[model samples]
Target: MPDRIEQAKRALRADLRERRQIVSSQTRDAAEAGIKEQLDALVDRLGARSISCFLSTPTEPGTHAFVTAAVARGIRVLLPITREDGLLDWSVATPETEIAEGLFGLPEPVGDVLGPIAVNDVDLLVIPAAAVDRHGMRLGWGRGYFDKTLGSMEKCPPVYAVIFDSEFVDDVPRDVHDQPVTGVVTPTRTIALASHHA
Candidate 1:
């Protein structure tokens, strides 16, 4: 059953990736503008003084503006640094922070490596996802890095997955290790999940 489910996830990931690749830069920029505005509102609603977030790649829903803007507003921001052992380290992200290519070709912060427990300090977490289901189950990249991180948290903050407007769907494959998010922030709306664990 797990194998079949994982196979389905692989197929879905391929499809989503292809869809993202075909989006014009202009459309993506427009979507990102809306997303940034929505994220700012979410932060205020949650009173999230500290946030853990990912630096998005070009093809993903752009988080570049949101991260920088949040930092400028004096919100404490932490960005992940992929480690070789599949665990993620974190570092404080400022507009001036130096970045370098890290694992999985992600732009990682270059400075002191705050270990995984750094996540416990955040009031909210905004993670990257390929897609999110109506139930808030997030389909992440196959690496399981975020899954492992969430699984280890004893008292997680409100975790939200950031996805494009079209990526929210009716269902996504689930495994025992998969953690559902509290909500999804799309370009057009913020959908709070009934299945939110925290």
Candidate 2:
């Protein structure tokens, strides 16, 4: 059954990837600006002083502006550093932090590496997603990095997945190890899914 679920996810991800690639530059710019605004408002709404956010890849809804602005605002932002062992290390983000291509060609920060457990202290987690369902089931980009990180947390914070406005769906295939997020942040709005309080 899990295999079937994974297969469905694979097919869905392929379609989503193609969709992202075709987003016009004009739309992309507006989306990025909107995403940054939503993220900033989310931070203020939650009163989060420290958070973890992923550096966006070019095709993903841009988080680069948000990350940079957050650092300048004196918020502690931890960026994910992919490790070979299928776990994530982290790095604190600053205006001076340099980005380099990491595992799977993902954008990662170059700096002092903080171990996996470093994320436990964060007040919020803003992560990547290929798509997320209304119930908060996130379809990641065929990688288990975020799932593993989220599942192992002792006391997970208000984890939110970042995606384009159209990536939110009514349902998605999920397996036992799949973790539901507290909410989702899209280019246009933020949704605190009901399951966040479950």
The candidate maximizing lDDT is: 2
In candidate 2, residue 40 scores what lDDT?
98
115 Cα displacement, candidate 2 (Å): 0.2
Candidate 2 TM-score, C-alpha based:
0.98
Displacement of residue 73 (Cα, Å) in model 2 is 0.5
lDDT of 2 at 193: 89
RMSD (Cα, Å) of candidate 1? Answer: 0.9
Score residue 11 of candidate 2 by CA lDDT. 95
Candidate 1 to truth, TM = 0.97
Residue-level lDDT of model 1, residues 1-198, one tens digit each, is 999999999999999999999999998998788778889999999999999989888898888889999999999999999988989999998879888899889888898789999999999889999999988899998899899998899888889999998999999999999989999988888888976475
Q: Rate the local accuracy (lDDT) of all candidates.
A: 0.91, 0.92
Question: Residue 147 deviation, candidate 2, in Å?
Answer: 0.5
TM-score of each: 0.97, 0.98
Candidate 2: clashing pairs of residues:
none
